[model samples]
Target: MSCHNPAAKIDIPKEAKKIVLAGNPNVGKSVFFNYLTGLYVDVSNFPGTTIDISSGKLNKDVVMDTPGVYGVSSFNDEEKVARDIILYADIILNVVDAVHLERDLFLTQQIIDMGKPVVVALNMMDDVQRNGLKIDIELLSKKLGVEIIPTTAIKNEGLDKIKDALYRAKPGNRIEEVKEIIDKIINKVDTESEALLLAEEDENIIDRHNIKDFNGQREYIYKLRRYRVDEIVDSTVFEVNQNASFKTKLSRMMLKPLTGIPILFVTLYIMYQAIGVFMAQTVVGITEEVIMGKYYYNFIMNILGSLLKDSSLIGQLLIGEFGLITMVPIYILGLLLPLVVGFYFFLSILEDSGYLPRIAALVDRALTSLGLNGRAIIPMILGFGCVTMATITTRLLGSKREKFIATMLLGLAIPCSAQLGVIMGLIAPLGLKALIIYCLTIFIVFVLTGTLLNKLMPGESSDLLIDIPPLRLPRLSNVLKKTYVKSIMFLKEATPLFIIGGLLITVLQYTGLLDSIASGLSPFTVGFLKLPPEVSQAFIMGIVRRDFGAAGLNDLASQGLLSGPQLITSLVAITLFVPCIAAIMVIFKERSWQESVLIYVGSFIISFLTAGILAQIIM
Candidate 1:
């Protein structure tokens, strides 16, 4: 079958052409995207999928960026998104890491076989030469039947040639045997891209095209293509030195058990000091207490009180205890904002420096006992940022079983940064023993719950298969940009929820519902958990937002309503309580309504039971 264009499948202006940037993970695709599009970029989920795609303008042409993938097929959501974009784009910018030319060429060849117009960006050229490797750019271009541009994306080298190379892009030569097999199925398939996918036995494409299954043919075609890719790399690339560098030695140490474990703890300690001690305490005190509490809250409440009077319902709604003016901004802007910034900033540094995957590798074995691989660490790490966003990210896990276990763990055990910060501040004053007990209890719960679920849940777990990128010094500009974007996204998503939560709390208070619920929960609070009845109010606030609950507890502790043991018990209970409303909604969206509800109910039981037992022992 001749190459068929799938560009017509998606709607775009007739005059507008698309240039898609595609490559394997950590191949500098983002750097290229930022270079081409600069600061003007929009990140959104692709239609009908949770995978995010970034788009921006390059001169008059629309430039699009796809999630990183090894090859173009529906092996995962990211690959599916990448394949769809490649299918629809007018041209492709295939970024290849020159140092890993042999490994990256497989995807490069797959794109070529799709008959899509492609310009090869042989990226990481500086890394190549620094490691004493070389590539014959012209020879590689000639072999693939596409233009090759050697680029060091970080240094902004050879980037200007990209625009001109777009016009010089060409389809890669196809394998004759594979072509023959595709020709036989040509009448059934509509596009060359679809044909290639079909030949690879892609179920999604086959189902979409209503084509017959070609199961055995895929292995044959894949092997043939792999052979061709090997031939291309062998002929066009040369490596001068085989000696391991310090980075290589460090990478080895990071993957080994003894060294890696200590490294992991040290890393966590550093993060805790940076985020928990410095940012959460020092930065948050200024932002939440001095700025928001002493200034903004007072300023706004005074103005609103004068305008509507303290007894007025409008005044209560605006500036009262549960008022939007008093609580919402303080919780979101003053409290959560600093924590989110600090968390994302630290995360971005780890991500850009290529340390995250190594950490994942180190933990893979331990996670396996919980029916997860190191891949679970991504969402777990992100859960520390925001469990709601992490729930959505659980889709990256391989199976429904993995996703369910991960989601449950996140909902039940992982406290978001905002809540963590407040919890730390509250527990820190109780002395080191209290703090250690608090952390140890949560960690024990996390492992035990995961182990229990692993046994109960059906299906075997998948192993971790991840790319380990070379460590590089993080770019300040890139790290700051990601931090800014993620922070803005957090604010936009969180602000409205906080306002709604504040309004809901005010209405509840005004209608006497808050008091009634607190009274109703007194038996559970006072009798079961061995805490003051007033602590029930914090539990109610937790349903609105996790941080709100923790902050409420902080307020009660400040007033001396909770003792050291009571503080520890309450912190543990709230930490494992029903996930905040936002997280529950996301769980409902990502999992089913049934699953979300079960998780909600299950967490409440587990949290209360655990806390009840702890309160009895500790007190």
Candidate 2:
């Protein structure tokens, strides 16, 4: 929605003032937002973008948490959104990282130039002090002509001061060069902020004002403002020593190839143990076999049977093999839920501990071979959570070609946690050798596909230019809260898809289409993949949901139908197959229908061929 149209997404009262929380990336803006809004919050997608905007109440004011950006301009989707919100804000709570003042003050200067009432939440004061640096806050405040509230947001320090300072907020002094330009447009615009934006040639502001285009003098203004920021820092900031702290030393080790590679593997192994063994085997077994299968499923089936006999369509639809009540709940709640919780828990820990960016840095060199940089690691890691969401995150990558390559790789080989859990459980019985083979096969396919796409896809991959946040001990409350939120989101998004898949299966079974398709694919399934004809059903289910296919294989393995080599072959094929229908639809939405179709068909052919070759050798 347009920033001017707060009624579209925000539920602020007509008389309520707008308080915008603004900041550079990773500067504790979200933490501040949470503290101000508490539990009263609404998150919705911006009208035409995938970016989510969060709005909530702070006392009587409507507080908005905007996307993190460096300076307010239409450089990208995120910057554009943040700029719009800034333009419309009555008062701006500009959160700044004390440790990264040199980098962050650029945005602060931009906000000040907008002539908006602003209160600087100088966050991360603890980190700043720990790093042997100190800021003369009073002096800095006088220099910037704004209230600077020193805060350690995670610790809830200086939060009350922020609220108290809000009423004391005043417009910051404008940059001299920008002021001259603002004077030129003073009659054209009502506020200095609008004039500054107009001088920057912001298209949205230009359109709103119906003003003629002016040559943007953004670079000249930026350079002048940047010099002033340097002067303020030099006069008001102090450093005791340049010694690297322990966290910095550790961060350095994580960037080196030798140490970083081992660290990466150790991290992945830990994740696998947590999700694969603990959650998949132990937790899932308890939930699926004992609670659901032994007790809940039986109880539900008995109740359904009593209500409608087994021969009835309603009874079959409720408790039959592909029944909504039986399969949907069992698969979603029992099988996938534990895995989702476990995966998100570990992911939240890593994210909160600030190690994910280090991982991106560590893998940057290797990813170059895949026609991606470290930034692509974000989507790849996210793919493990949910390929559909990861598909949307591909926007973070640089070019269409990089996005295409990343999307293709994700579709071809990345298995989401739910599918990985089932695949782990199914293959765990075959011994470590079998699991190793399965992993190796998928890795080979991933590397080969990425390398081939790198060669064929015509474009240059962007270099990695990411800000590395300092490592901090993860807060248990924050980690748990994140896990809960992400888990709920996963359930909300995945439940309907699982239910729909179950319905599709039930319809196919009732019409004998499932059997017909299985029979038709027997030659390839049985002859080439060396899998039983029934395993063909899993391949079909893969299109509906990748984990559904893996779940189907789990059922076959449980029934003693799939042997060691056959199990490996089946898992390999399914893992390398196309992602779920949701991901394909997202691909179509993000890219083009032609690209989506090509990804689907290409993945299928590659998966089948790879599985066939591997099956012959293993057999």
Candidate 3:
């Protein structure tokens, strides 16, 4: 919903025509919206729904973008919002994927049957050519009875033609059923759009218009409409070659479990090198130790030191080790920022190249065993970057049971990017054996916990129904834009959390509460976990930020405090600990307070109990 704009809410001129851009998912509507709107666009939450509607101006016409849907119906919030805007549209600028003529044309035909003026942007024609498919544009135009502008949205080809053709858009051919339905219901409804939706048995539309009652013809109408679309596609599209392209062949390899699992590992290994090893070890070493650790620290302290010299208490709060000015920025910018940016950059590429969905499809079987479909992998993968953001992504899952299970797993097992970086660094010196132990332990926990939850939870996971767009080289400009915006959002979210954590720690340290708490946790920390009392301090810090906890352990390791087995045990425990404050807050926001508390307490007990058993054997 976000990351693209510093866009101010724009007001449409009262006299302006509302031009809607509608299409199936991944048909390149956003590209067209960006080109047409230039740098200025508005994303406003549609009334009475959580979905946002984007608007920009094209001359006197107001260009709006709706969620990509097969048809406008009230099945979901996305469809309902799209249905409303589409209903009110003065002209529908339908963007259709040329390669998906039969599938994409169904919605195009739906709009046409509603008697709404619409212009078709027959997009991805370049893909159509590369895939060895041909479409007769003249025949398609004549068949649909609308202007069909073949466009390659990425290359900016035929865009101007689409803009110019808007003025010439008119209603296309209507089927016999639509004409008959309109004749029966036109006097009852205010608009042709409503009549079309009512014919489809749209409950919301029927309620709004106060329809007495009508028999459901939705299934029959859909069957006929699909038949009509297939008819048009049969006449207009042709296969130029019988052979599959190389990309097509590779895509198949990506879907099969045999090749796909290895490909997934290679992708994960690359990500680990880039974000965990390179960004965490190399980039953070320079930024944290050399830049912020020495130069910026000394410079800021020197200038501010003299200013706060008179009040020792004030100086301790502002310039102390846990000071907001000292620790917050250092951690957020110097330590975490590079890792976050790297992770987002990699994620954007997976999304843009269309490989993310393939990963989901490949893992569907494995995830199904965990009471989740392949689609749940999106949030699971995202949980590594930031559990807070991933919690929001859980809304994408179909059922309440799936969302609850996904949220629980994320809170319990997944380590965020910042924490993952630090954890990787800790495990690096422990060698390959320790690394394997760590991976095996976490993997076992993930599987065992998920299986138990599946048995305990009612209802079944929904099947993965996702789009797999033709894989191609991702556009660099698009990828970078996504990375930059998402990184900015990360900084914005992390900044406040770090500041509050630093401030709270400063207060606790000054009041002697931190030491007192550490003393109080001696039974659990020293006796149960068999770690030193100082390790309790890191556990406390881990509550604020998991990476901070791991970094604290790193400091202990640097000082030659923790033995190897103890270090490994502590690492396992901390990695499985309750999520950081940011993630905890998000869990509370996403789930009920009862559920949130249950996850937190459950993770705490599981983390220590599991790690404690390992401590007995290893240490």
Query: What ranking emerges by lDDT with the best candidate at the front?
Result: 2, 1, 3
Point out where model 1 deviates above 4 Å: 1-69, 72-200, 203-243
lDDT of 2 by residue, 122-234 (tens): 99998875776779999999988999999998999999788878878998877877888888877876667778887887787777767874676765676687788878889
lDDT of 1 at 611: 97
Question: What is candidate 3's CA lDDT for residue 18?
Answer: 81
Off by over 4 Å in 2: 1-69, 72-243, 306-312
Q: Quote the lDDT for 178 in model 2.
A: 84
Better of 2 and 3 by TM-score: 3
Cα RMSD of predicted structure 1:
9.6
Residue 331 alpha-carbon offset, candidate 2, angstroms: 1.3
Show model 3 residue runs off by greater than 4 Å.
Answer: 1-69, 74-201, 208-242, 305-312
The clash count of every prediction, one per candidate, is 1, 1, 0
Better of 1 and 2 by TM-score: 1
User: Per-residue CA lDDT of candidate 1, range 293-376, in tens?
Assistant: 889987885676567776667877788877877878887878889989999999999999999999998999999989898999
lDDT of 2 at 344: 86
Candidate 3 overall lDDT versus native: 0.85
Residue-by-residue lDDT tens digits, candidate 3, 1-619: 0111111123557688888899998899999888888877888887667788889988867899999998989899888878877887788999999987877888999999899999999999888867767899999999999999999999999998877798898999888876797778777677877788888898887777667768757866786787888899999998665465888668878998889889999999999888878888899999988898889889889899788852466777778877777877787888888888899999999999999999998999999989999999999999899988999999999788888889989988898988888888778778888888888887888898889989999988775756678898999999999999999999999898888888887777778899999899978889988998888888888898888788788888888889888888888888899989989988999899999998999989888988888888777
